[model samples]
Target: MKFSTNELLPLVSRLDQLLRTAEIGDYPGAFNGLQIENQGVVSRIVAAVDACEAVILQAAREPGTLLLVHHGLFWSGAQPIKGILYRKLKAALDGDLALYSSHLPLDLHPSLGNNVLLAKSLGLTGLKPSLELKGQSVGVMGKIKPMKREKFEALLCKSVGGRVHLAPGGPETIASVLVVTGGAGGEVARAADLKVDAFVTGEGPHWSFTAAEELGLNLFYGGHYATEVFGVKALARWLSEGTGLPWSFLDHPSGL
Candidate 1:
């Protein structure tokens, strides 16, 4: 049975509720819902890690696809609709496409979030929250037994499937490491607070390198796009299984 946009709204909201209960994002953060809607009839769906121009173009070509993304437009909250942004929105409006996004909530979800899922995929145990963001933990810290730094790096490289930059902090044998997916390397100091041996994340700032050096915590950069793709794909799988909408991933390669 086909589900109209209005019919699917509650289902989407239910899915969002699940994600929110799991602590997907800051929760209080803005732009967590349906950002744009069309004529209220959605036939096909496109799920991507980021809602970029390319993904929007793909959605446009799909005619009635509802674009579900991890990162939505208007991150800065408000911006003049002109240039590229204007073009993207025009494309969606002209094609009658709808847009929905989930950010930090999708990152920390235990079953389908980027950090926890990556921890599970790597067979990490004793997963706990990071110490950085008080009142809430946005990343997962865990134990990895004792392994050589090179071997651990090899594992991460294989898991992420790209060039990984490793900054070994302390001993060659690592007992515990922290995992935070996508642009979270800046929180490596949180690993120091927990006394973790290594930290794995998508990308980090220049200060992250210096901080890891001083803290004696190994740092690994797994390429933000590569690390973040899994969670949305997992979400798409859940949507297919739960709502029987038959979802497919719109793989838009992001080189960042």
Candidate 2:
């Protein structure tokens, strides 16, 4: 099956509105839209957390594929398009791949976002948006039935499908949790201000452990790559269900 690239315009417009891509403030390098165009047609959709060279090359295996990702190319800012960068672009162009990226926009999306999906997976209730970044609430705070901190950690570990680093700074029992997936560990202080019993995030700076302890906040560090995979997968599934386009996820873990 194939779809004209023009057929993607409506889908892209719907995504832009659904994610509020234009309204949301993100890193200048996010470039949160269609970063590259295909040869005016789409054959399949590929979703991944990052648009690294390996994933791009994998997408290139199928010509006319739409590569959807959370982290786009060019996070490090402009540089001479040579070496790995050059190879990546060449592969995409050669394979007629279209690349679309959504960083903060996808992270904060209410129903289909990384934070919300993870929160739901953890069986959280009373979820509300929290943790402002760039003038938008990029995380979720919610209630979990009080449980022993160790049990809570185990549940989180299962949900994220990896080992979790815990700074057990809060009480023995945990009832409330604030979740901001992917590298938001620096927001420990802000989460502390929210007075939630625990904060769950991807990786953070080294000092975040001490800060969590001092601030009386339990911290769970699920791997950054693990926690962030939800949004892209959810988005791809959504697009497939809506548009009847086949989609696949490219798993490239950066075990950070």
Among these predicted structures, which one has the highest TM-score? 2
What's model 2's lDDT at 70? 95
Evaluate model 2: give its TM-score: 0.95
Best by lDDT: 2
What is the C-alpha local distance difference test score of each model? 0.77, 0.89
Question: Model 2: number of clashes?
Answer: 0
Query: What's the TM-score of each model vs. the native?
Result: 0.90, 0.95
Count of backbone collisions within predicted model 1: 4
Q: Against the hidden true structure, what lDDT does model 1 obtain? A: 0.77
Q: Candidate 2's C-alpha lDDT?
A: 0.89
Which stretches of candidate 2 lie above 4 Å from their native place?
A: 1-6
lDDT of each residue in 80-176, candidate 1, tens digit only: 9999999999988888888878787787777888888888777799988675463668788888869999988888888877678987776788878
